[model samples]
Target: MIRHATTADFEFIFELYMHPAINPWLLYEPMDAVHFQPIFQELLERKVLYVFEVAEIPVGMCKLVPEEHRSAHVLYVGGIGIHPSFAGNGYGVQLMEAIKLFADAEGYRRLELSVAAINEKAMHVYEKAGFLKEGILRKYTYQKAEDRYLDEVMMSCLL
Candidate 1:
């Protein structure tokens, strides 16, 4: 189940965010808990973060940001990640479905996201969830630690 995250969920959320298998694809640079706390708290206060639970245990998280421009019909999926231990069990698909449902319920006309070009696994999951490749964002994301730029694929699914 997907629901709004609370401050109490911080420890689990931190683990998910900094997991070795998941953090590389995330937009934020890896940092210690002390440094990440402020950002996480901000996200919660902004009310854009949602946590996915399996049998009452948090297993994943996602961000849904509503577009504020003229195209208010679009909702951007900022990021989504399942715990590595729960990966490959269709949880990603479930999360995508939940995002789509949330978008539709919120009257969004499209759901958009950008995935790192090298993240084939996530690309496949997005494709299976009905998102189509819209374009390539050349050298769109920079990895501060690695000192490299990574290409990203822009994708969207009409709601």
Candidate 2:
């Protein structure tokens, strides 16, 4: 199940965001809980972060930010990650399917997201979920820690 995140989900959300297996592709740099608290709070306040669960146990996370006015029918998906422990269990596609349902229910006509171009694994999952690659933003994401820039591929699934 997917639902709005609560303060109680801090730990799971943190682990997923900071986990070595998941963090490189995410937006935030590695940081201690003390540093991430404010960001988490902001997401909560915006009501964009969501917790993905299995039998009430938080197992993944996602962010859905709706566009406004001219693009109101679009929902941008970000911060997507499945707990490393649950990786390879086919949950990624399940999570993607659920996201689609949620977007449809919310009346979004398009679901969009970007993935690091080199992240073939994630791209495969997104493709399985019906997202089609639109284009690549060359050297779009700079990883300060690694002093490297990664291309980001834009993708969208029409609901």
lDDT tens digits, residue span 44-80, model 1? 9889999988888787999888888798999889759
Stretch of 10 with least lDDT, candidate 1? 12-21
Cα miss at 11, model 2 (Å)? 0.7
lDDT of 2 by residue, 74-155 (tens): 9999999999889999889989999999999999999999999999999999999999999999999988889999999999
Name the candidate that leads on lDDT: 2
Please give the lDDT score at residue 136 for candidate 1: 96
- Per-model clash counts, in order, read 0, 0
Each model's lDDT comes to 0.90, 0.96
- Could you tell me every candidate's TM-score relative to the true structure? 0.96, 0.99
Q: Could you tell me the TM-score of candidate 1? A: 0.96
TM-score of 2: 0.99
